[model samples]
Target chain A: MTLKGILLSASMIALAGAASAETRIGMITTLSGGGASLGIDVRDGFLLALEQAGRDDIEIIVEDDEQAPDVAVQLADRMIQAEDVDIMTGIIWSNLAMAVVPSVTAQGVFYLSPNAGPSQLAGRGCNQNYFNVAWQNDNLHEAAGAYANSAGYTNSFILAPNYPAGQDALAGYKRFYEGGLAGELYTQLGQTDYAAEIAQIRASGADSVFFFLPGGMGISFLRQYADSGLDIPVIGPAFSFDQNILQAVGADALGVVNTSQWSPDLDNAANTAFVAAFREAYGRIPSLYASQGFDTANLILSALAVADPSDEPDAFREALRAADFASTRGDFAFGPNHHPIQDIYVREVVQEGDIFTNRIIGTALEDRGDAYAAECQM
Target chain B: MSAILIVEQVLNGLQFGVMLFLMAAGLTLIFGVMGLINLAHGSLYMVGAFVAATVAGLTGSFLLALAAAMAAAAMAGAVIEMTVIRRLYHTDHLDQVLATFALILIFSEGTRAIFGSFPLYLDAPALLSGPVTLPLGIEYPRYRLALIAAGLLVALGLWLLIAKTRIGIQIRAGKNDREMIAALGVDIRTLYTFVFALGAALAGLAGALVGAIQSVQVGMGEPVLILAFVVIVIGGIGSIKGAFVGALIVGLTDTLGGIFLPEFFKLFMEPASATQIGASLSSMAIYLLMAAVLIWRPTGLYGVRA
Candidate 1:
């Protein structure tokens, strides 16, 4: 072969090698069906942060889990084994997160959670390989419980779907509230009707009601709760009445109270920029799911800034635990179990002109951990 | 439970029953008349909801949006019946199931392509927005009571249309003996189209009504569809009266079981364990009822054994 032709082939090989050296992160989330709105918010938030970074040195592989735990595990396996993703992130459901965490962590790869910190992982099952950029499973609900106690809402009722997360939420609320319990109703998960429960709530004569019905369940319950004409005030965590739900409930959610770690109305430079950039890109305010996704990506990027991008798995794992992300929550530190320590806020749904958004009424809590954390060995 | 609470729960159960009837009536009619198990029926329901939501957003009139949704779904139903479902009529149930399952994928992806993977909302009309006090001093949402009344009216209207009309006789005949009716000079193909369209319209109506209460998005029909299937299986595959009875039973069992079962379990188990066990069992109660009914009578409660 001629020297000229050999040189040309060598240059083509060199360019391809340069392109393959970029850091790749795999993001799996629900992007279809009922949960699509929240998933879109998460995807947009992560992409926005990546765009702002303006680094061609990183690539994102986005997969839709379709809200199924089996599909999530399959996608995680494919992303790790076939695509060779350097880092894994983005899951909405706690069960789906639980399904994939074991495999991802056992592979000795970094797994950052944008959402869904189940209590088991926050406590006894905690792993150094898993880092949650979101609040613990019970943190927001505990804040609501604290607020309920302060408001003197004794004789309150609790309702939640029957699931691990639901149980954790109720346990979290009862932890802080030293009130007379009226009743607790555990309904089937994915139940669309709330009439019987509403009747029971009214019958119990609870002064207030606290519930944790996330996703479509929340929409169904809040609408029916308003329709039932029960005079008691309804309260829940942000997952039950956030932006995704506001689109469905509209003015029906007016005056309902909730608690969360992140709100779009949070008055901070980091949060303001995050909200503005997200709204510009997605034409809607980011939900907590989105904030968590953006934060997880930022966390990974910050760790990369500290450790060499080309470092081995041991170096990358050390860098991640160092806690270096410029978080929108303003001052987040990881606890021993790798879950975040952050403040939680009590927010009320009120109208700003024609649009409805969560207004921060008070900061009911700060720097809280899951109730089971004292048992955590990690 | 207090008398007021019990009264409220019963009403709630009735409202839920009515909604289930709307969904089950369509599914049963299609199954009985066409002898085809179209799993993608739920996708049509989702389409109706999305169309209603988009129309409501654009026009801001709930009535107009509801009308448009029903019409759009019926039109889509007719077109699909002609182009796709018509070809599957003579095929086996397995083939029909597989083909319709594929249609679900197409419809879902197509919807995502258009709607961009976000939920759309529909608002209740102002006329039915607030609560109304009943004679017993109980306040229920005017819309829900209206829904219960409307559902009953539809059921009555359907009964009259099916029992007292010429088309009703033809449909009953079609369900019983397809070949004999076809030999007697009636246009069987046209009749099938009409039956499918009627079922699709009912499913669409259910979707539009429920859209006001729930978010409209892809796969919204799935849960309702499953419940409807349970309704038909319990009520009998081909009987509207059975659908009504089955819907009420399923609804009450679901709603009441969820509440009372946990309390019952609490007598024996701790609150947390009772909740976990009771909630799981309550969700399974209707299915258990269905299994017992089927085992006792090989056909459903009202089904005519083939």
Candidate 2:
């Protein structure tokens, strides 16, 4: 054989390998109707981070869920079967996340969560292929519970909708709080009125009230809470007090306390730059969900840098576990169970001129894991 | 539960009932008068909310936005009735249901196309912003109280319009015998248009009022519409008084059951199991109540025999 022929054949083989080695990630998140604002923010944040990194070898297949669990499952299945996604990520609700994660991971594909780490996954059910770039389901609420305990509230009433997430939230609160619970009320999921619960709380004579009502339920509860004229402090997790509810509740949410792992006002170079870029691009303040999504994309990008693009699943999973990437929350590390161990802060809703925003008042805990971590074999 | 709490819950239930009545009243009127089951009624509610939010954003006046919402919903109702609903009057129930379901899809997609799929919000006016003290040291939201009062006033107004006025008599006559009324030279088509418009206006008002307390967005009205259907079915198919009563019972049972069921279960079961079972049962309480009511009174409380 001639040397010229050998060199031409080698070049042809290299070109074919490069084309097949392209890495692809599938993103499924709520992106239409009521949940669209949050979904759009997450999508934009992820894409922006990807663009800034300037890596064309990685491709993303983003699908809108419309906040339906069944649709989320279908989209995840499609991404795996048809698109042949190497990794799956981005789900906003714990219920939807729970539904999709089992299937994605069962197929031996890596599933990374930008948001929604349900307590079950953080505890006994933790899996090696699943990683949460966001905090555990209970971490933020545990912070709120810790804050409430510190405030000397001996008897507190609690309310949440009756769902797995809701039950987990109450359990999360009880994990940190060592006090007498005056009453615990679980209402129907998506309930619109709080009058009966308000009456019960008033009668219970609790020192304070802690709630875990997210989405539209949060708006309704906050409005009714204000209407009931209860002077007791109202505390909740960040999901109920974020920008989505802030816009609906407005002045009514003023002085309400909440706990979160990430806030727009966090002091860090990455976060400051992120907030500015997000506001410039979207014309709105980015929520923690957006920040987490941005971080997840960066995490995957960093892992891609370590693993050979042609490396198989096991190699990619190891690279992801290392997770050496810049995050808006600053210096975050994943626990053995693949959930983030991060700082949680207590924030109060305050009016900044005409706009309402959360202001950090105290740090409840730093680098915490779920209480059920002891039970997790992983 | 203490007396005060029970009273408060009842009031809450009544408030919820009244809101359902507003929705159910329109639904029942349309069904009784036209023999049509319009599933797109919820879309009209969403339209009212969207319109109110947009106008309020532009004008910065809640009252004017509310007025505009009513007018816009009425116009929308009239247009839908003339163009789409008129074609379905002679059709069967299944076809009517399917067409209105299609209208829901069209309305939702069209709304998203115009509003860009994000939720729009409406703020409560300053006057009704704070909590007001009611009799017996019960502090309640002024806006909610206002809603209850408005609902009662609407109920009275509807009664007077349907019972005392000439249009009311014509409507009653029309409902009793549409062909006979048509034979008597009544413009049945115009009367049908007016009835549909009136129903739409009520639904619009409910949407605008509720939007202040919840996020206004596409598909927002669907859940409430389902409850309204349950209300009318339990109250009686064609009876307004039945709708009112059924709304109250359903609302109170749902709210109170959610709160008390877990506690009740805790008496016999472990806390965790009780919570799981209780939550599930609370969601089903109203449906169970409706079933029991049906077993006893199949035609509903105020339903007249056909």
Candidate 3:
């Protein structure tokens, strides 16, 4: 064939590729506010997996939500109606996820949630089009409660920010906890001052504290709690003690146990490789957010390899349910509601020279699925 | 609550109030004298905190950090006022708000570029880390007590500076009439810079001092800024005396309400609902106080007719 004929055939293949071969993903997450590091880690991890996979057919579009629900909604609309992305994911906060997920998934776009899996989406509100690789919002906190019960903590003072996720966290703790509550406090979301809360805790004489104040709020609380010298063991979910903010929590973070499904040293092949490769690429230890991002992206890739999700929805959904990819967490399966059903472990913040990261102390809940899965009709 | 607990809470309120005063003192002064509504004041507070943390991290000295916080913030203020704010003096409030809001984005992004997204460490010095046991077995964090004492001392010094000094008189006169002060050959531009720098230093001092207890991170100043605005509004926009009294009122009201309201509700309702109602009400308590004050005295507690 002549050169012109070959060019004509290449253009035909390219046109064919646009309709059938390519996978377009739109990620909307907080990237420019107090919670930016979480989204940044997720983006980096997802991209790293794509790089490792070396897939030419995948295209990613990223946008910053700045932790605002309206912005997330707008971004989702543009992605779905205008950009016509096949898959949407990477929402960091539950509020934003709630705002973006229902509408996007309603339009028949598959949403592979990387970070947030709000309780609303896990139960009666669960959509067949949405799959959360991350645990349901309450899984880790529920595990924390179970850990506290087994660890002989009778009187626990629990605290969380006053938001949907926070409310879910407190409820989750209460579900598994057989302990007597000394106090249950709901603080302002994004509050940095924990002095008054510490004073109350100290005076209450609670045996332990279980708080779910993540990001800067967690750092503030832990630092103040350490300085107050209350001598109470502090336990929480992994968000408060993740590697992203551990160094800032500094000496205070040591010995505080937080529950998570994944850690830097999970002793699995995929996890070990992900950690090493992430450190090599980003020059820092990967957090749980990063792990979730990698897993979510890999889940998409795995499903796409098995079947074109956009072309055949049922086949893609089944492939996703199969859980074909190697997860950073060693063993993983999707629960009935498309959320992760795996082990959640308690990790203690430990120091390795100047570096700080979490080390798995013990398992909190094994082979566990979310409580809301049974409530889902789907 | 026990009497001892009540006493500790009062102290907590005072401590919180004093911190607010430090932030509001600068805000009120800049507003009263310069007639400029600056949304970027929080950015200055953040600047002071980042500088203090950075310096404290390097030198291992809290004193140096405090000094550096004031210096850096004042310098930032001086530079900003001379370059960007001076031109906006005649502009309406909306322009100032938009400009300052943009400045917040710049400061936050610039700080992120330099510090990464992680919070910085600036612990209280060893000398102030332990708790102070008072009589009646009430143990309080010594650093907080010290913070209260320092805040009171600054309040006294501020009173002295405003009441007895020539610069204070000139500032008062300028607030009343900027054109007259300029015509009188008082170097109004320089004075404006000095006032702005002074306010910036105060904000920075608050940030540095508070940074020890709180996590020093990007956008740390924004929350404090909102509370400080409440202080100025209640204290009268330009009145330092008003700010001090207003700060104490706002501070005490916020802290005590947070502790007691929930307990009060717990007496009447189920524990969970009581906590929920109590938390929500306490958050709104300050705004309610502000509203009541406005209804009673429209100009605020110390506000005067312009």
Which has the greatest DockQ? 1
Candidate 2: clashing pairs of residues = none
Please, what is the whole-model Cα lDDT of each candidate in the order they appear?
0.81, 0.82, 0.88
Can you list each candidate's DockQ? Answer: 0.61, 0.57, 0.49
Which candidate gets the maximum lDDT versus the true structure?
Answer: 3
Classified by CAPRI criteria, candidate 3 counts as acceptable
The list of candidate 3 runs beyond 4 A from truth reads: A1-21
What candidate 1 gets wrong by more than 4 Å, as runs, is A1-19, A188-190, B266-272
TM-score attained by model 3: 0.93
Model 3 residue A184 CA deviation in Å: 0.3
DockQ value for model 3: 0.49
Candidate 3, residues B1-306: lDDT per residue as tens digits? 667668878888999999999999999999999989989999999998999999998999999999999999999999999989998999999999998898898999999899877677688999999688888888788999999999999999988888899998899999999999899999999999999999999999999999888778888898889999999999989999999999999999998998899999989899878877887899999999999998888888899954
* Candidates ranked by lDDT: 3, 2, 1
| Model 2 CA RMSD to the hidden true structure, in angstroms | 6.1
TM-score on B-chain, cand. 3: 0.98
- Chain A TM-score for each of the predictions: 0.91, 0.90, 0.93
Q: Is the docking of candidate 1 incorrect, acceptable, medium or high quality?
A: medium
Error of 2 at A137 (Å): 0.4
Residue B4, model 1, lDDT? 72
Model 1, B65-162: lDDT tens per residue? 87888887787778888999999989999999899889888988898899977667677788897688887888877887877887888788878877
